[model samples]
Target: MTRALVVAAHGSHYNPGTALPAWRCVDHIRQTGLFDEVTAAFWKEQPSFSTVLDGLRSNQVIVVPLFSSEGYFSQSVLPAELQPRVGQAIRITSVVGSSAFFTAVVADRIQKALVKANFPPAETAVALVGHGTVRHLDSRQTTESQAGLLRGKFAEVHTAYLDDEPYVADLVRTVTCPNLVVVPFFVAEGLHTQDDIPDALGLSDPLYESQVIQNHRVLYTPPVGLEDNLYTVVLALANEYSDSEAAADPGLSSELYWTSHQLAQFGQVSLHADALCHVDDDVNAPDLEILDTPEAIRAKLRFTDSGEFRPLPTRRDLPHGWKIPAPGDVSRWAALQMIYPGVWKVERTCSPHEVGARQQGKYRPVRDISRKKVDSLVQSVCLHCVRHPSWHDQNLESVPGCIEPCSVWLEEAIKP
Candidate 1:
């Protein structure tokens, strides 16, 4: 039996930061041994809301929404896809906005800002900036309600937005305090939180990148939902349900990922290569063959067992500043030398070659350890793996916004 957690949100198709905070929380929670599998999905991004549930293996899945409001997307759109028409153990948790704990998290951030930035509540006013979309009245309701929670501590509480009146820029006119603390009421730090919010306020520096904006003092803080304490709110929501009956084994097929980065650290190839890039089993893979001229190298066996990220169209000549450092194949060493003779070198084994001529071989059940010596001998350097067949073979057409850059050397795929 197995259990899984899905952290669902609105992610970016272009910007990675848009969905990172929620993904970061999902990853951190996964590490605590609460679930066997953890994954993330977004409405505007890859592994989209339309297909997020398909990858889940656990019959008992706890899905927690990372959104800031209980809007149409959360109440209707998200539930419609997840709620079973007949029966299933899948449970959906509350959005972060409804959690009173989230309000406290925001308050906690305000208190910290007052301490670090030296702006006490007696002198500083807090402005909670939100999107406040005019298309839907419910969008601004949470931002308006959350202000009541922080009113007692601050000299004055101001609520502002980008689309509605009393916009983010108008904060300069509405609040009279000499010191103002601005906290973005967003789920993640992306274009709006990091770039647009600053530009709207006529700020030269990036969002939350400084304690003070311009000459006059103003404390800028990151998105509120990303506060560490909010993880408690998520766990609490899932724990509300009673324990379920035992589940069946998750016999799901997993795709393999590769990267030299992880292979260098552990001196083992199989255990860590999944860190580079991966995709769930759905899309059909194209026939892939790794060949040098008419001959395929022995290293090709590593890829034969599993696929890699998007494959390159035609091999580009090695970039000037980059080299393979150690090409794992002894057969390819000659060809690599033909291209750039001094680019790579093969390390010799530390065997008693001079004393004895006898050689013997035997089958090893756990071959993962046998490759360690070769992996250690090879000098692995960073390569732009996005184009290689190894990258393309995983069947992912594009990288997700929330996923960190792939480091293939780590078995756990994501690297900060």
Candidate 2:
């Protein structure tokens, strides 16, 4: 029998949001019976790239990155990891949730979101926010390309990023519209979703109050996450493999399985050990700002393994021991959108025209790319959702694959 494995992705550094979508995708695919097995892995955290290949039950593993664009992780990191398994009876194909074809899907979601907020194509400044990286130009390029497409399809669209040039604030300043709308082009509401973006715009946490920028002329919308539209995105990908013939390789499967198991086991052991001791007070604690830096977090943790963390502490809970907050607890991960409505058009009832009519005097529309291909598999996905809407719930929670953030250890009482 041929078995297929589909892996999902998010950027990681012990952040649940970074790894949650990947795990959720794997579980969703498996429940639909579209693949024999599906396993989720990450660029950071547990089930490292080195270990993911070890746990494959099928000779064919289809790795799908959940990221919206081609960047370092997709271009450099993913390719290097898969190179070793090239001809070893294991084949890997890269598929992702959102890609070039997703612009239309996002455009649909954006228009709906704007309409509900009483935003118009004329005075409304549509800001496309992305997590741009200085390390790779592709991050900004992807965001820029997507914005250009949106401008083509709709009027008054502007592009911005959390990093690099043409910063978000600068881009938003260039829009001539009296009112502005910011849409985060991210997969989930994580650190950037919860903290960085809002901080950049001078908005408060639990950002519900719609305040005007430079005196009520500009408005910011809550982020887009967990919308029913995402369900549509997921369905599109699963349908791609529903009819493909499965190719099996027992030897390859065993190797992948053992490697993953060992890596998971090692991670657990290291966590246990790290949990045992308090941070040495003698060392200067890293500033709260540095926790966002992965290398800084790694250096401060004082891992005994010389590279990673040690085992978890067996004690009930040490006064000096570090306890990382659950991803769900991060103020950054909290439901900031719930406090604010109209982030997604799903629950709101407002006509697109009625919302934008107020600002309908001056603006520009951007061209959008339409590249969606519907196949027989898409029908299969529609059927799956019809039969089992609850399928995603099973994987919606955080997975065991993520490594805890270094913040937990920072909270401990340091000893000299």
Candidate 3:
């Protein structure tokens, strides 16, 4: 039976760095060739939780949440979104943060800090900072549990939070150790580790590896999620789940229904002269980059034409003057996936009503806004994006419409 692994993560809509760790983990897992297929599903990014499994070809699939804790997203959101189809067997594993391998990773991170500072563990304190919330006790509990495991190993092991009591700011001010190591327990580095935590700790430099604050030498490490060995944690969780679960039906293949013939033109890309080329490229355009592989195309799309980072790949700012030589249908299809990750599956399956339903379920904040406000937001945000609104009919001859509102649209609609 063919098996698949999906790394489900809470990817940021505005910050591209938030999704890098999960993608890196997926890349490593893919290299091992442990499963028939490996992909990533994100709550706030493309190939979202609602549609990630729709095109899988595996009979048995394992989804491992890339969250750092068993909080709101891991417990509630993931289960609600990842519903399996008939004859398809799906197993959702415990969040990666709960894995025993993760505890070792945390311990290793702290050890590295101690060794670099030449500070004895008995003289230094360690702070495990987590993004805790009052809505769920699991986050705090998991963090404290990890800290508990290391309590006797160090002079003091404390748990701090961004939301709950014993907050990050308080921990920085109250901790008495002359040498403290602050390790962010986040799944990835983002606004929290890069800005909030550093600011709260009164560190002069946000990217400082070590700094003295209030006469106390403090060492700040990168978030644990960014560790190169995170794929091991994912592997451990998948192995544990597979061992306990029963065999599943060898379901029908869920390969993408659309063909390259159906993809003649996308937002700013088109098939021309047996190659997938940018709409603006011509003989006059200089510095044209030749992308020979789908991976190369994906890497190129990480930034805009003007050299700015593009957090949302669906934006209208896809760079020009680059082309993928797609002499065959397979190459064309692969190029499309790199240019528009999950659009083909969405275009093939989603109807107007289904699109509306997806939008209603995913963008709950849209309900609170007035119709006029919603229209204005859509005009400003959706119109400029590469995706056509759901109102447009899906035709292979034309650019495909979006199946639902994107995260950027939802974020703008919910703005106070």
lDDT of each: 0.53, 0.45, 0.75
The list of candidate 3 runs beyond 4 A from truth reads 243-257, 261-264, 270-277, 282-286, 290-299, 321-332, 347-362, 365-380, 390-401
Candidate 1 lDDT, 1-416, residue by residue in tens:
45667778887544545655665676566556566556666665434453455445465777888877777667766775454322237777778776777788888878887887788678888999888777678878888888988888889999988888788887866667778888888888778888878777776554454444444477788888768777776666655542642332345222211212322221111112222111221112333222343112212311223333111111122211111223443323333322221111111111212101221111111123224432332223113222212221232322111111111222111112
**TM-score for model 1?**
0.58
lDDT of 2 by residue, 19-122 (tens): 44554554455456555555655544434443455444454555666676567666765665543344334443333423555566567656675676666676
At residue 253, give the lDDT of candidate 3: 26
The parts of candidate 2 lying over 4 Å away from their true place are: 1-3, 11-14, 83-98, 216-416
Error of 2 at 390 (Å): 38
Most accurate candidate by TM-score: 3
Q: How close is candidate 2 to the true structure, as a TM-score?
A: 0.55
TM-score of each model, paired residue for residue: 0.58, 0.55, 0.84
By lDDT: ranked, best first: 3, 1, 2
| Ten contiguous residues minimizing lDDT sum, candidate 1 | 354-363
Residue 394 alpha-carbon offset, candidate 1, angstroms = 19
Q: On a 0 to 100 scale, what is the lDDT of residue 63 in model 3?
A: 96
* Candidate 1 lDDT score relative to the true structure: 0.53
